[model samples]
Target chain A: MSKDNKEELKNDTIKENQEEIKESETLTEEVLEDIVEDEVSELEEAQNTAKEFENKYLRVSAEMQNMQRRSNEERLTLVKYRSQDLAKKIIPSLDNLERALAVEGITEEVKKGLEMVQESLVSALKDEGIEEVPVTTFDHNFHMAVQTIPADDEHPADSIVQVFQKGYKLHERLLRPAMVVVAQA
Target chain B: MSKDNKEELKNDTIKENQEEIKESETLTEEVLEDIVEDEVSELEEAQNTAKEFENKYLRVSAEMQNMQRRSNEERLTLVKYRSQDLAKKIIPSLDNLERALAVEGITEEVKKGLEMVQESLVSALKDEGIEEVPVTTFDHNFHMAVQTIPADDEHPADSIVQVFQKGYKLHERLLRPAMVVVAQA
Candidate 1:
């Protein structure tokens, strides 16, 4: 009888230990599930942060490009009009020279002075990148026909006959077109 | 005697407890000191970050101001030169009319045409902020004295004798000075 009682007590002890082991396994499963969920949320948060950084980079780059383009356009326009004030100052000198030459039957000394004045004008204009437009032949791009003159036997048709106003070019672009009379067939 | 021994043992136990409490207190103090250091570092980091932001703000603002100044200057220059090409275009018409009137005595019809042409020239120039500098008096700022002419009784000493060149103004600014002969006593 005593041996049977001892055996029963040992069996009870084993049963209680098995129950404790089962409870620990369930707790471990719960902890593993929580860890996996936490990892997924952390990954999502890191991805969101990277996306925000990329957006900021793109915005800044676009702004920088706009600033550069605006400055470049302004620089180009400034160069285009660089000779305005100087041209204003020099036109009166040209008019004075013209009036002096227009006096009927100019003296030899006055003619010499006029030549010098023309030379000075040419040099001053050249220094400022001012060039005369070509007008020996008719060119549609750089001449405006105010009149059409008939072609003679010696003169070729479509040739420029007279230049009413001299045209100027600044930096290879036409500042003004030559007002011209062209010969026609 | 036994009571005295018990009291001594009690005192030993109390001493041990006191030492343990002191050790725990020291550990807590060390932890608090580390936390304070971390807080100080965080405060310094925040201050440095704020200063960096301020520096960037100031640099961007200064650049914006420089760009603004340059843009205004360019716009003003564009306005000044806007009429230069147009003026060059119509100058020949005026020159042609002027040449026609220069012939030996003018008829009434010729005089009327000349007056009309002159009026048109004046209006065109005035519309573009262009004006002629006065030639009745000589001024060093707007006149170049080319010679000293002998004055008659009608003119005063040190006065302008004649204007060789007609001066011009663009928006109250001197474009050219009149070339003149001055009289002296």
Candidate 2:
């Protein structure tokens, strides 16, 4: 082949190599851009997953704390009202003993024995946070109005006139409201 | 400039361009490798964070469930033992009534009234899950061995001879262990 033709062919080959180099450089930039975009989306997805799990953890932690608080409150309330059921059952027997003491004609010995029993039972009830409903103001919360009477000057309006049966309470909880007569205007 | 010098200068320019292209190609490859490594490590870190959050969420959820279960159990126990405290307080009063009934020379009316009170109090206690501890066999759980007597055929070893003071129980709990004489060989 002629030297001129050989040189021309070599020049063509160099041009082709330069074009290939340019193409590869463009491809690198494109590939890097694509990779960065993919990485960003993947990182966002990972962050969303982490955030979701964190939210769930926080919610469950709050629920556990609330449950503990509620349980403690319930325990305190139960302990406070622990004697409620037994006190209710014993109140009637106390009423019966009081009636027995009220009946006339018992000898001193019998009346004394009955009085001792009555005092002890009442004291036991008192020790357990049981007490008769106060007969001061006619409060519906503690006193049930079985009968109502006209308000006289002596018995002011909404005042308790008479208690038919005693009402007892265990702490703040009313076991049975006092069946009573109230004076109303 | 001379034609030969111009040709040589053009050749030097081509060579410089080629070397620059080669360096850029190598840098592109190095940059791509570093980017992929960085992406892999970042993804791993993200995944690790997500896994950590998931584990914490699971732990907290389990804790919440366990707390709820425990709270239910505690509530049941509280309800079951609700009457225990008041019943304990009332037992001594019951003992006093029993002693009052045991006294000699009381009139029939007084005796009847005392028996009625005793029966009513006992019934109330039974309704509230209070009961006299069984005196069949001497059990330390429900019976306190205050006195010991020599065992005979009539009272076998480990049997109960007599209860000094009656013991009582509220459900499975011993409110007071019976003071008893135990028969031992």
Candidate 3:
């Protein structure tokens, strides 16, 4: 072949190789970018999953702590009101003892014995956080108005006129309301 | 320049470009591999964290359920034993009433009233899960030996001869041990 023809051939070959190299570079860059993008997204998804689980764990832990606190408070309340039902059941018997004491014609020994028994029972009840409800201005929470009398100059409205049945309380809770006659306007 | 010289120069340029492309490919492969490995490890770490958090959440949920169950059981037990203290205090008073009834020279009316009070009180106690402890054979768990009598044909050893004071129980728990005379060999 002529030298000019040969030179032309060499130029064509060089240009073709350069184009091939450019194409290869572009392909490698695209492949690398695609792989990196896919990996980054996968890693992000894993991180998101981990965060969600962590949040759930934290929420449950807080709920458990709250439940424990609530249960303890409920336990204390239950202990405080433990004697309510039994005290209610026994209040009527106390009334009976008072009635026995009020009876007439009992001998000195019997009267003395009954008084002793009554005093001891009242003391026992008191020790158990049971006590006679104070008779003050008639409050419906501690006194039940079975009868009402006219309010006069001496007796104000809502005043306790007579306590027919004494009321008792256990701590702050009422076992039975005192059955009483109240003055009304 | 001569055609030969130009061809040699072109060949050199093509060789250099090829070498440069090879070098670029090696570098690209190394970088891509490193990035992929780093991302994969990060993903694995995140997945492990998520698994750990999930396990923690499950454990906490179970603990809460167990705690709730335990608290409910304790509440029921407290309710069952609510009357224990009050009943203990009242037992001595009940003994006082019995002593009052046993005295001689009481009028019929006084006796009747005393008996009525005692009966009502006993009934109230029974309703509150209180009951007189039965006097059978002597048992230290339910009886206190205040006096000991000689064992004979009529009274066997470990038998109860007389009861000085009645014992009582509230539910399954003893309120007070009975004061009693026992027969011993």
Q: Which residue pairs clash within candidate 2? A: none
RMSD of each: 11.6, 2.2, 2.5
Docking class of 2: medium
lDDT per residue as tens, model 1, B39-98: 555555555555555555556656666766877787786777655443443344344444
- Compose the digit string of candidate 2's lDDT tens values, residues A17-50: 6887789889999999999889878988898898
lDDT (10s digit) by residue, model 3, range A25-118: 8998899889989988988888898899899999999998998899889888887777777678777777777788788877788788888888
Q: lDDT per prediction?
A: 0.62, 0.85, 0.86
Model 1, runs deviating above 4 Å? A1-68, A78-185, B1-9, B81-122, B150-153
Sort by TM-score, best first: 2, 3, 1
Flag the better candidate by lDDT, 1 or 2.
2
What ranking emerges by DockQ with the best candidate at the front?
3, 2, 1
Question: Taking the candidates in order, what DockQ does each have?
Answer: 0.04, 0.61, 0.63
Query: Relative to the unseen true structure, what is the C-alpha lDDT of residue B177 in candidate 3, on a scale of 0 to 100?
Result: 85
* Candidate 3 lDDT by residue in tens digits, B76-116: 88888878887787777788888899999887777888888
Per candidate, chain B TM-score?
Answer: 0.74, 0.85, 0.87
Please give each candidate's TM-score: 0.50, 0.92, 0.89
What docking class should model 3 receive? Answer: medium
lDDT of 3 at A72: 89
